[model samples]
Target: MTTSKAFIQPLDRVAIALMLLISLLIGLIIWQGDAVKPRVRTFTWENQQIGSEDVSFTLTFSRPMDTKSVEDNLKIEPPLAGKISWAGRRMVYTLLTPAPYGTNYKVQLQGAKDKFASQESSNRLVQPFTGAFRTRDRAIIYIGVNPEEKGRLILYNLTQEQKKVLTPKDLVVMDFEPFPNGEKILFSARTTNDQDLLSAQLYTVTTGIASQADQEPESPGRVDLVLDNKTYQNLKFDLSPDGETIVIQRGNKSNPGDFGLWVMPTSTESGEKPTAKPLKSQPGGDFMITPDSKAVAVAQGAGAAILPIEGDATKPLDFLPQFGLVQAFSKDGSQAAMVKFNTDYTRDLFLVTNQGTQKPLLKTTGSILNCQFDPSSPTLYCLLTQLVSKEQYIEQPYVVAIDLKTAQQKPLLVLPIAQRNVHMNLSPDGLGLLFDQVVAQEVNAPLSGNTLKTDDGEAIATSDLWLMPLLPIADTTTADIKPEKLPLNGFDPYWLP
Candidate 1:
């Protein structure tokens, strides 16, 4: 009986301790009483790299709150053009246009207040919260003029407003495309030895370097020969947006049988060797690598072929066998500008989509130089030459913008008939067009049998660069939307990727 009483006495003390614990918990609960301000769980995208597709930012908070206070207090230093919205505790800021690459941006929240209120005051986030981020490297690279600078790849930084030559001075860059990351430039260059233009090989030069210390060592990555084949000449090549594949149009110097589309892995198991296999198709003509990079729209004879780079390479989707050229594809690969050649060799331009038939835009008796689909809209910009006289083959060239919705074409600029190498380049924002024109005296340039030539013999001329706004704005009227000549004397101007 004595032992039983002893055990019961300890049990009673244990019960008393349990009761005290519960009372303390209740007191703490009463003290809290649901009085809390929205707390920042995290301010993300801190000093990280973003791309064009990454046009949105997310901010998470500890609790849901009023969207108005946050929107009013939010300020992006340097001011990014964007829109703001709210979702529960997340503050989403979406950019109307992608932030230009190679820049630092800061976002700040001042005097942010939550929806909840206490008896005495409104619950507010007291501290000024800030987040910092960076965009991918960006630049417009072009070939330079002057014999010394000619063929040199020029990297003009859009963000830094600086320029750097990326290629060796001895190499003359014919054409180039930048990888999506803006890190390296893949170019076709030939040795300045008066060598056959077909001797040009594919090479990559570093146009970008990691500005952040945490990134891969600030390496001006090596300029490596990506593909070198003495047997075949690499002409035009495109790197897939996903950076997994490189589709090159190569012409065998000796055998016409070797002329076709070649698919190669952009990366290798061993950096020492590059492996490229030919796609099972007819000889290549003009083609655009799809944004998805899995397939390419190739110009096969008078038709367009969509051939796959992987899986069953044997099968291809053929479209419009009468169309001689596939000028361009839309950003989403949903639409294309196709050109058909008549028996007279005159070209007719048509707009076709992935799910639709060819909608005729314009037909020209001269030639269709090049055409590109605007990234943000259904408009297609084209450079076409109109035959002024078929007898002498005299031509007048113009830059025209065609609206796919209305099927109306507007001539934006009319260039001199002699501007033979005219190329139209749209700005990254899709608001401006850059092109080149030649101003020269018509000397006794005897008519060249192949190309457009003057009745006189001397074909001496000077090339001038020009820029024109492609958009409607408050500052410029449509009548006043003339091409402004740039001081830069260059051609084949391409917007950096």
Candidate 2:
């Protein structure tokens, strides 16, 4: 009995020792794995709001990396349109062009080693890292509805089929411009107070939620104040394509004649910067922002002047005195559209080059209401109106597309005279034109916060927005085209860049 007990006790002790030794070995392995591996300090928004224009990306690591190990091991799934650079423990990838929207991207690093680890095992990977990010869906924003949704900005994601109301309660938003980066919106808003329309002030709202190392998880859409010109009245404002600058039109509190274009940064990043400073431009007139944001075409006096946003604003470009309004500028900033008004109220549309040379494109007894340039082609979409009935002075308005190179003009849509508060827009892809036709039986009173002409200078009966395909026309004539109806009621519809 004594011999049996001793043998059993020793065997049990041996088994316990083996178990303890196995546990100790496992702990050592885990500790070594953590100690030798490098870490990444991810930028919360690194891949969240990637747009086609986001050319640069930055990645930071906890330790200095072996340049060759990372450069050779890093792989972007499906490939991307960009180049890469290294900086100590950081990596930067600059895109040659914008990444296509609505895509999922995966980044994998199979054989990456830190500098210290390279000394021990030159080809060994410290750890395998994998991350996935997605490009934003195609989205559109428009002001819609009344009573409950009045004066609010609505964001509709086309890919996700989602809708989000961006603005908070009760501030009547008049006019808003989205930044090129799609990260913010520069808007003019006025209180419920029935002040003069000129009293509208510019404010910036954060439409994006950037990832931060220190911030709590929060939803985007934060409204922030930009500039409130208490003395001068602010009007039309345009945000530059790069999202760096803003050009605004302001009028004096008492003298409407004392009006000019102003320039300021479109950022509230440091809080409301400065009330925009007046540019060297002529008195108030209809104007358009050049793509470069360096110049603007102001329809002043009897001519259209291409005035620099900075520098000698007084010394305007000596354009043809007969050209009255500058309509549209090409996306590449190479060409422009200018109008020449005749003594008999006849309107002539001319295509102007960047070198200030002008060529007449269309001549008609009609007025050019609005125009937009096609981003991908040499086409100009212009709204034309002519007095058809001399007795009633009834005018008919139509949308026409003109091929600048061919000097061919094709009528796209014949709008009804009852269509009021109409504006034309070309989709970003250049595949479609989006516009809205509003008609009212009774006189349509202009919405207080509305900036663009809300009241139909004449009367329009039923208001609905539409989308028309821009391509697939075998006939250069208007009959070959058919517009699809979009089930929405909005005046100004703009596609995101």
Candidate 3:
């Protein structure tokens, strides 16, 4: 030993110390590797609420998990119960029986052990969930029809089980008007139809079945037929809000040239035919009655004219120039919507007041087929279609709505191109829209033998009645109340109010 000590230097001793320190670090790493505890970074769930069907869960480890160990140690309760099948790494548990409508469930995962014998603690999770929904009731539809038999009005309430028919036989129902109260209906009928052409036969509906005498004759149905003459052509008629008077367009059907405006009482006594008085002239087109029932808006010649029910007899309303075809009036009677055309036959919508001031409501690159005011709101809905080229006669239809106050135009609905001859009508509440959509189907014929011959067969024409809510115009997602084929092919749908 003494001989070696004489040769050993200080540098040799330092090198030996460094080698021992490195060896100690290597041994510590090997011993600590499997013994280190794993920290759970976070707990996640597939869903806080689970259904009664199948539920699955997954656990993420800070390090790569031993798939074999997890599959062997994982357990679920109320137990998989033969209803669950594992999907590789994930453990799935399904209930053998469906849980109640609202039931709370618990999931327990047993701590899994590692190859080094390190154990993971157990975790518990509770999930509350609900079951599926049940079915709903069927919708009901009310149908109104004026039978071909004179003085007969039939109202049928069609439901899933039975149909209820309401016939006021004692009262000759002329036209059915939905009462403001909605419980009962208001109708004008021929209480007495005097055979005489111009007899003052009193026509009235039972406010209460003839209980009193004076109430019957106070407001008789004596409507005047303005275009009674052979040359007069009937256009369209609108009833006043009070249902006392009607404004109609009288024109020459044969000539298709002459036109005039007429005001009638809308009711006549038994055997008494109400007389029509001329309101205005000059090739009358469309007419609308103001809600206040004090004025009538008539589309004549080049513009719309408002005639006061109680004004100067000599002069007609000052024409609101550039506004043609006054189609509708706002609910407040403060605005009138009309359409005008140019030399190229492009139609545009314009709004005007009874004072003869006019402004553009909608400016379209294409023609506007028809437009109407929402009876319940200030919005104006229009049906617009592109002008069909000479080469093609059929064109697609689109519905657009314009806020009268904001002057914003937006598309409401775009019907399929296959639907032609489209017409739209707004409901009384302005919350629903009714439209007639015409669809055509091609018919094919089977030729002799196995060969098939395709030829243009009879085109099936059908007019369907469609209804949609006015709200959520942008979504265009609506539940069709009832899409029914017309009992008999008909169009020009109008709601009675």
Cα RMSDs of all predictions? Answer: 5.4, 10.3, 25.3
Q: What ranges in model 2 sit over 4 Å off?
A: 1-136, 209-218, 268-272, 355-357, 444-462, 472-481
Model 2 is weakest, by summed lDDT over 10 consecutive residues, at: 209-218
Instruction: Estimate every model's Cα lDDT from 0 to 1.
Output: 0.72, 0.70, 0.49
The lDDT of model 2 is 0.70
Q: Measured by TM-score, how close is model 2 to the native structure? A: 0.69
Which regions of candidate 3 deviate over 4 angstroms? 1-235, 251-259, 267-273, 309-314, 353-359, 375-377, 388-390, 418-420, 439-461, 472-490
TM-scores of the candidates are 0.81, 0.69, 0.48
Q: Model 1, 105: alpha-carbon shift in Å?
A: 5.1
- Of candidate 3, the 10-residue stretch with the lowest lDDT total is 447-456
Query: What digit string (tens of lDDT, one per residue) describes model 1 on residues 325-352?
Result: 7888776777878888888767788888
